[model samples]
Target: MASSAQPYHFGFKKSKNGELPSIAQEGFMNILQKNGSIFLGDAGQKELYLTFDNGYENGYTAKVLDVLKAKKVPAAFFVTGHFVRDQPELLRRMNDEGHIIGNHSWSHPDMTSLTPEQIRTELDKVREASARITGQQKMSFVRPPRGIFSSRVLETCKQLGYTNVFWSAAYRDWETDRQQGAGYAYQQVMSQLHPGAVILLHSVSKDNAEALSSIIDDARKQGYTFKSLDELKVKMYR
Candidate 1:
């Protein structure tokens, strides 16, 4: 089934007053369901999925990996073609250390604006490039660049054998120069804790790198288990 070309920027109301964040307002949930995409897991279970967008190396991913390793957490790193080309060792290490390497598109363009074939090229290039280095032949998950997508983009991803992964929790941690310190990052993440949350973080943020260890530790203390994307089971909410 084909859908409209209209683009949607992914977003949701942040959880507050001890509530799960809602993506219900904009038909985000509906579209995701229609396109076989996923933004949340089973809300009945206290499981959290950690994912990072690594468009380029800002010199913090190694530290992020270190923290994940030290804490025994498995996270997914959605990388762009540039990241694969520039940081082969990091990619290899991520795979070796038991992390899923995902696709964030080749040029990090708005996939909604590209044709299906163009979209395929963008995704294939990253997958092939990544496989060569990481030796993990199957790159199955994709997060669109800048959280922008449409029905067409989602369908293209499915046709190309990818599951589009959106997030249920995120904050403005992408602005590298305006970092508000690790405590602020910690607070932003901690406040949004809920069952089946897909947390999106940018590896370039120094705040995320600094706060990640605490985030994992405290979440576990609260009884939230961090699971790999492979273990994720999509749950549809109406």
Candidate 2:
């Protein structure tokens, strides 16, 4: 999108002469510009955007798909080249079922640590694979691996015609052993949810698959409808 009309504002540490410290000024500006709010369409409308990352063919994806299909809900799936190549059918199913498929980089490297060329390669590899499998060029959304991104990464995504999507809400269900439980994860997600909240879940989590439908149900009960990132016309901060 559109750039947010909201003015950039932040608290800053001042120097002895009352001027802002250089580092603090830069940090504050970055925060203010990068921290745009996620809008879920109209005001007073409770909408939740569900997104999944690092999808591989664990067969749990199918179960997750089943639940979404049953509920007539759509979600966004960020896939790597490896997953797309290994599970072409599942990728196809995701596309065919009307879910948004997004790039999550080829090897899920920490983009901030990679060279600009390496980052481009990571994005290009995933874009090429996703296009090959889905016959669609120009995937418009991406989430950095581990939610790590630099200014260079964000600029790279913009140059590649992809929007960098990050979540407003997430939990520790990515770790299989540390997942607390499905019910608890579900409760954590739903409880913290708000309008325009992008809830990040991992497709690889067994607890997540178990909690998926219930989370959707409970979010609905609380009057939050779900939307894909593509459907959300959020103002870009940078």
Candidate 3:
């Protein structure tokens, strides 16, 4: 379970209105012309976006939080419903600390494999839950489980007012048991970071938890500033 301070570890809860914010039809059309994914942030500057997936009641999240707090940096956490139901306080803490909480679906299912209705149901459950917990209905970002998405899934998310996010850089760290060490993980992440890079990591990995501070430190030395997904003003497409 997630701690009460960071409920984002779980999936979204319902919002009061049961709907997402509306996007400009013209802008949406422009987005469709480019690609299926959203342009989350301006690539003009050397900015980095740090996002974590599938967090639970691990003590590591606290360590990660300590590092972020020390640096006064913000991040995004895309959570599952199971994490939310178990750790409401952690979600609250995330919101309190100015971190963006995104939906990773209720059960982290592969949207590409499910029907449109099923996908909607899965997303909706999380949205409603998130809204209920946070008292806000502005969750507009989602990252499909395992990065698997389809046209139907994309369209459904757009209709529901969510921009699907995908990472530009990631490495093998999801495996908790055979996890890579911090030094190696740091090398993997640092070597790939670039302008507008969205780095994906998992909170449950010991290597990731250990490597996060160093990764941020190295990136900072290279003149990179971390931005939360919301700060990017991502333009949704497709």
Candidate 4:
């Protein structure tokens, strides 16, 4: 189907000068939220929203969930249709244990390249499947696969009744074999910490899973509290 939507790619920009929650970043974030999407939370708070992009299972999500549970920190797990189908138990546990199950698209396609109807198809497939598993028909948040997005896709999702949630803090944690030392992982995460940061983690990384507890602990030690994505405030409309 043809779509009359305008595309706007959300580039992944990292300013690692230890002076983040940058003003420019905040401005961009403000624009998106004003227009019905969000990349960061309210720039006024020292809060972190923990989110995981789960395209598929790599056997470490359970452990990651365990950490979140033990630490009592709520997180959002953005999943694909394959993830919901392949790991129903895990998906159910995430829901049962109070984590937000976000729609990450049915097949994890590059949504910016898809027309509105195609995007709806991708989102609805997961939406219905997720509701079947979680009993929540409305999945409030969606993260475009690989961080690919456009206003067209964002608005499409918003029309589909979801608020787009993007991340402000992430690292090269998706590569399973090229894993960094826990210290390195710790620094990568901790160094990038800032107020209203939306920290993204991949469930497939063992290092991310291992360093998670300490990350949360140290972040708390640094006076930052973790919140689920739903807890964060958004403008929802311009």
TM-score of each: 0.97, 0.81, 0.80, 0.89
Record all residue pairs in model 4 with backbone atoms less than 3 Å apart, i.e. clashing: none
Measured on C-alpha atoms, candidate 2 has an lDDT of 0.71
Estimate candidate 3's alpha-carbon lDDT, on a 0 to 1 scale: 0.71
Clashes per model (N, Cα, C within 3 A): 0, 0, 29, 0
Better of 2 and 4 by TM-score: 4
lDDT-wise, the better of 1 and 3 is 1
Report the alpha-carbon TM-score of model 1 versus the true structure. 0.97
Model 3 CA deviation exceeding 4 Å by range: 1-36, 39-41, 233-238
lDDT agreement with native, every candidate = 0.90, 0.71, 0.71, 0.80
Model 2 lDDT per residue over 4-59, tens place: 22222222222222111222343323532353323122323466788888656665
Candidate 3's displacement at residue 58, Å, is 3.6
Between prediction 1 and prediction 4, the one with superior TM-score is 1
Better of 3 and 4 by lDDT: 4
Look at candidate 3 and tell me the lDDT of residue 142: 86
RMSD of 2: 8.4
Using TM-score as the measure, the top candidate is 1
Give one digit per residue, the lDDT tens place, for model 3 in 1-238.
Answer: 3221221111111112212212233233333323345533455667888888864656577777778888888888898998888878778777788888888999887776777788889888887887788876778888878766555566678778887776656777887778869998988788777666667888888888888889998889988899877777544221
**Backbone clashes in model 1, listed as residue pairs:** none
Model 1 over residues 1-238: C-alpha lDDT tens digits?
4356779999887876447777888666777888778788878889999999999999999999999999999999999999999999999999999999999999999888999999999999999999899778889999999999998898889988899999888999999999999999999999998898889999999999999999999999999999998898766453
Ranking by TM-score: 1, 4, 2, 3
